[model samples]
Target chain A: MIIVETKNLSKVYNPDTVPVHALRDVNITIEKGEFTSIVGPSGSGKTTLLNMLGGLDKPTSGEVMVNGEKITGMKDSRLIDFRLKNIGFVFQHYNLIPVFTARENVSFIMLLQNRDKNEMMKRTDALLEQVGLGDRKDARPKEMSGGQQQRVAVARALASEPKFILADEPTANLDSNSAMNLLDIMERMNREEGVTFIFSTHDQRVIDRARRVIKMVDGAIAEDTLISVEAANQ
Target chain B: MKTLLTIAWRNIWRHPARSGVLIAAVVAGLWAGVVTVGVLNGMMDQRLNNLIESELTHIQVHHPEFLDEGYSRLFIEKVDEIAAFLKQDERVKAFTKRTITDGMLQSPVKTSGVRIRGIDSESETRTTNFHTNMMEGEYLDSSIPNAVIIGRTMANEHNMELGHRVVLTFEDVSNQLTSSAFNIVGIFESAGTDFDRRNVFVRSSDISSILYDKAVFHEIAIMLHDEPFAQSLAADINQNFSGITAQTWRELSPELNLIVEFGEVMLYLIMLIIMAALAFGILNTMLMALFERMREIGMLISIGMSRTRVFLMIMLEAIVLTLTGAAAGILLAIFSIRYLSSAGVNLERFAAGIAELGWDHMIYPIMSTPEYVTVVIMVIVITLLASLYPAAKAIRINPLEAAKDS
Candidate 1:
């Protein structure tokens, strides 16, 4: 069953002069449990495409239907509520609030959703352990390694138990080993919890790990490929 | 809300030097506000008290006709009945009846036209500082048929001594010329320069004698236990008596009343300027912080914190800053005012200016409960106003752009 779908979504920036085509005529559909990568070269609108899919940015013209709701036409506030309830985001920079500890960063989304304190704590602790950062929960982003911070960000992204997660270059700042570890952790969550993971990345390692890959050029999809069982099992 | 306050408080301490500078600015603004208000309030209080203690009692009762041309008219009849009525009122602390006449007091060297207040000296001593402030000799002995007490200026001008006789003359109630010889008994000095230079204290009987008629007092003065109660008491007295007017001390001294009025105006003006500075200061700080933390704010919005909550968090920071500053300001004000209250700023050097302004030269820094309470309220108001600019900026902050700031 399709959990997320975008139809002919396009985003245009600086339309009148020196116009930049950020997204153009993008069509994509993701099943309930899938690890997908929107892969492209620099400035190929991969992040913009992911932003559109996650309901973070509305398409200039077209529709983003997530969980059967046309999110593209929703008000900013209702869209925010949709995002909080059905989607989670992990950014390239980890984007943890500098003032909060790793555990607090994970708990912030649930808190904003006005979840009960005990439930929030339980989810935060569970997600932190799932990301293998149970011991580093008290450390601030600045006090943690790039991999540790990214793991905390991922833990935070999962704390709300959203149907899908949007990670924009989740391991772009880490070393090869840390990157591999983060990808492995995300893949494990995708397989075990049936949580769909959508990532935009320029890194080939992320493309290699994705169950499906969509390659983009300029602002439109150039190619879409489905990974066989052989590739996933490898 | 708890998270916002926690983050705001930690953010304040994140850069101790910056916070310190802002806090210092707050402290200085508060101190200046407190001291300015304190000294002005003190001067006003002194002026008010001196006016009440030195001249007008809380209320005065007199025949309505006496208020019109009564100074020169010599219309002192029915004084005993009025005094008896006022004395019976429970709220009346002390009351005095006095005959006042515009007359010429002449000595061998000088003759000055004076407004003579003829009093029963013993009752006046209880109600006013008349006897205590007398600079020489003694108060008029009413039993002495022609005894008088003059002002120090009068004594200095005429070089008169105790037992010296001054000729006091006025018109009789029947509109006939009359005169009397009174022995100089005492001399007094106070804030009233005109009064000291020209006024003479004569027994009521002497004034009656000078008028050559059975006499009554032109006015009655009533003292009260508290200054604030004076106005209400005066109103009650005025309402109860149909043919009389009760004049509170504030009404009697328009010049002194200006000090109180001026203090209120100056306080508001100072608060406005300080609020402007505080708003700018807080906005400048918050904007700088927002500029630097744009990415963080965008990230929070992306994580589903509403734009309204984001704005509220920033506003919370501003409130925290101001409230902290206000706390510092109040402490500084209390400490400084208490200190000023002790050493008391001496404006005696500005004696001429003080005299021209009709304020006492010595200013005792005064803080009434209401005035101090007002400062606290001002601090809160200023802080709330200061938060507006920062909160507006935070609300307008674009989540997409802010998240991309890095």
Candidate 2:
């Protein structure tokens, strides 16, 4: 079943002067528990597509259906509430609050949900162990290595137990080994936890790990391929 | 809300130098505001104290129309009943009746119109610090009907000695012309305006005999044990005496009130200017910080933090900065003012200039507890008002645009 769907999604910038079209009539769907990667070159609108799917930005003309809710036309405050309760995000920079420890960073989204401190600590520790950072729980982002930071970021994304985790260029700033580790960890999470992964990336490693790859050229989708269709079905 | 506050604190220290300058500006503004108000309040207190101790008592009771129209002829008779009533109230520590009249004093060479204040010498002396103001003569002698104490300047003008007699001529309350010869027993100096210079004191019995109404008195001055309760005492006194007016020292000196009020208004305008200028510095610091951390703020927004949270964080930043500065400023102002109050800020060095301007030569700035408290409250209120624009700007920031910023 399709867990996320977009129809005729389009984004325009400065229609009066330059009239730049970032995306045009893009239609896409992702099934439940699928690891989907959208790959594109710079300025090819991959970030915009991810933003639309995550309800962070509204497309000028489109309908975005996530978990049976049309989020594209929702009010901004409602969209924020939806994002807070149902979605998690990972960024290229790892985006850990410098003041917070690794475990604190993981627990931050839970705190946003106003969970009790005892429950937050429990979930934080479990998630840190899940991401293999159990020993470095008290370490701040600056004290951790690039791979460690990215692992903490992934742990933070999963902390809220959201139905979808959207990662935008998650490994664009890491070294080759760090990128590979991050991709491996994400693939493991997708396989084990059944948390849907939607990544916007140009990294071939990430694309390779994805069960299905959506390729974009210019401002339109060039190809959509199911890498392990039989395995994904099972 | 707590999450926003936590993030706000972290954001404030992100740029130590910039945030430090904003804090310093706020501190300076608070210090300026507090110290200026404190010093002015202190000076007004000193002046009011001087007025009460040296001249007007806490409450002055006079005949109904006498106080309103300054008519000495309307002096109330049988004030013993009022005096006895006041003596029963513990708040009234002391009371005295006096006769105030305008007349001309004539010696062989000099002649000037003078204000004669006839007091029950023993009671008036006990009720005030008037004895301390005597220059070269004895105070009023209630036993002698012909003895008087004249101001130092008046004695000088008449070239009179202690043994010299001056002839005083005036119409008594009965509209009968009368003349009495008074010995210049002493010279008194009260550093008031020309009013004090023209005053001559005599015994109340002497004036009562001449006026042919020994039961009459011009004013009944009451001294309160607790000065703060003077207003209530005056109200009570007025209630007791249906037709009479009971006035506190503050009401008698509207000009002084105006002066103090003018200083306060000026200080408020100055504080407003300082607040705006300080806010400019803060706005610069906060906006510069926001501009530098564009990507950071954008990242926070993208991570499901709402714009409202970002706005609240910035406002909290401003409030923290102001409160910290206010704390520092309050401490500094208090320290300096306390030291100054004890040792006193001597205006004697500029005495000649101040005297030429007809102001007091020695000025003691007097800040009370209430004035200091008011300064603190005002600093907080003004600082909060100053933070509005910056906080609003932070809230309206678009994450997409901020993310694109370099």
Candidate 3:
């Protein structure tokens, strides 16, 4: 089923004095359990598109429907609630709260949802183990390595059981081995749990791992290609 | 709410040094405010006590015309009846009658105008404890014939000592000038230099004999067990008596009444000024903390923390910070006031200057419980006001922009 769709989406920065077009009439569809990557160079609207899809920023024009609800013009308070229940985000810099432990960082989204203590603990422990950071649950972000912190971020994104996770250059700060290790865990989760993920990146390895790739140039889509639908099913 | 509070509490300690400095500023501000008000309260209390105990008793009675016209003929009528009533009243601690007349005292070298109070020596002492203030010699001894007691200020000014004789001249009840010779048997000192210089005491029989063959009384002063009952009792006296009027100490001294009323307003004004300063310090600190945590706050917003929750968290942080310091400061002030009250803050070094203003040399600091409660409520209000701008700034942060900036 189509879980996310965008039509004629556009964004303009400083539209009054010195307008800069960040996205122009973008259209895309994302299916359930799909591992899709949007690849582009600097200022090619990859991050802006991800922001629009996550409902973090308002589109200048057109509709972004997530799970059948038009979110482009939703009020900020209502949009925040929608995002909490439907979408999760992982940033390039591993944005786990520094003051919170690895387990607290992962369980924070559940806390925001007001989950029961027993359920939150059970799911938090299971998600941490899936991300391969079960032993590092008590450690803070500052105490963990860059790779470990990023894995905890992924676990946090999944804590809410969102329909899809939007990752913005998730491996941009990791080493080559750590990048591969992160991709391996994400791939396993996508296959085993039928979790959907959409990524915006410039990394060739992430692009290589994606089952479907959409390349963009200068705020508009240049190409859309399906690398392997059979491998994604297995 | 619990998680929000936890976050707020931990956020304050993110920069321990900065938080510590702000807390210290709050402590100092509150401490200074409380101490300054306490000292003023102490001075005002002492001044009121000195007036009530040493001079004006709780209530005073006089002929209706005596206060308006200080003539010797306007002495109170039916003095025996009033004295009899006061003696049987349970509220009356002590009472004294005096024959007062404005007169001139002639020393060996200089002459000065004085108000002569002729009193029954034993009752006068019982009512005002006037003999406790004697600096030298006896207190209006009846055996000495024309004995007199003069204040220290008056004796110093006239260069008179114990046993020196002086002549007093005043108009008699029939409007004739009468003169009498009296020897100074005592010299006393009081807090008020003006009162000391203007007043002298002599035996009632001596002055009454010269004024009229029949006894007369000009004033009746009553000391009550509780001063708060003075107004009601004075009202009762006015309703029951004829040809006489009774006045409480407050009515007799309007200036003291004004001081007592305005002193509370002054205390609040002082507290407001200090709290305003403290509010600025807290505002600056909270704003700085907000700027430093912009990225973290943006992340929280992106993850679905409601704006109301974010606002509550920020406000809670400020309240916690301010109340912690305020609690410490109030405890310190209370203990300090109690200690100094017992020991007395002595100003003997400025005795001459203070005495000239009718104030005692020692003061005991005092603060009521309601005053402390007011201070606490003021601090909370100030903290809320100070936290507003910063919390608004926190919620206005755009998560999209913050994500890119980070």
Among these predicted structures, which one has the highest TM-score?
3
- Supply the DockQ value of model 2: 0.30
- Judging by lDDT against the true structure, name the best candidate: 3
What TM-score does candidate 3 reach? 0.92
lDDT of 3 at B338: 90
What pairs collide in candidate 2?
B42-B366, B42-B367, B43-B366, B137-B186
On a 0 to 100 scale, what is the lDDT of residue B6 in model 3? 77
What is the per-residue lDDT of model 2 for residues A128-205, given as tens digits with 9 covering 90 to 100? 888788999999888999889989989988887887988989888899988988887887888888889999999887
List the candidate 3 regions with Cα displacement exceeding 4 Å: A229-234, B84-92, B120-126, B129-131, B138-143
Between prediction 1 and prediction 3, the one with superior DockQ is 3
User: For residue B75, what is the lDDT in candidate 3?
Assistant: 92
lDDT order, best first, reads 3, 1, 2
- TM, every model: 0.90, 0.85, 0.92
CAPRI quality band, candidate 1? medium
Local distance difference test scores for all models? 0.80, 0.78, 0.89
**Candidate 1 per-residue C-alpha lDDT over B1-406 given as tens digits, one digit per residue, 9 for 90 to 100:** 8987887887777667877778778878877877887888887777777766655777776766666676435353456656677678677778887888777888998899988888887888778765666887777853566888887767888989888998987776777667778888777766556567778888876686566546667778889877678788878767766766667766766666777788788777886777678767877787777777888888777777888888788888777776787788877888888887888888778876565555767777866778767777876676667777767777666657533737
lDDT of 2 by residue, B103-173 (tens): 88999987898878888778887787777878886887535458899877677777887878999887787
In angstroms, what RMSD does candidate 1 have relative to the true structure? 3.1
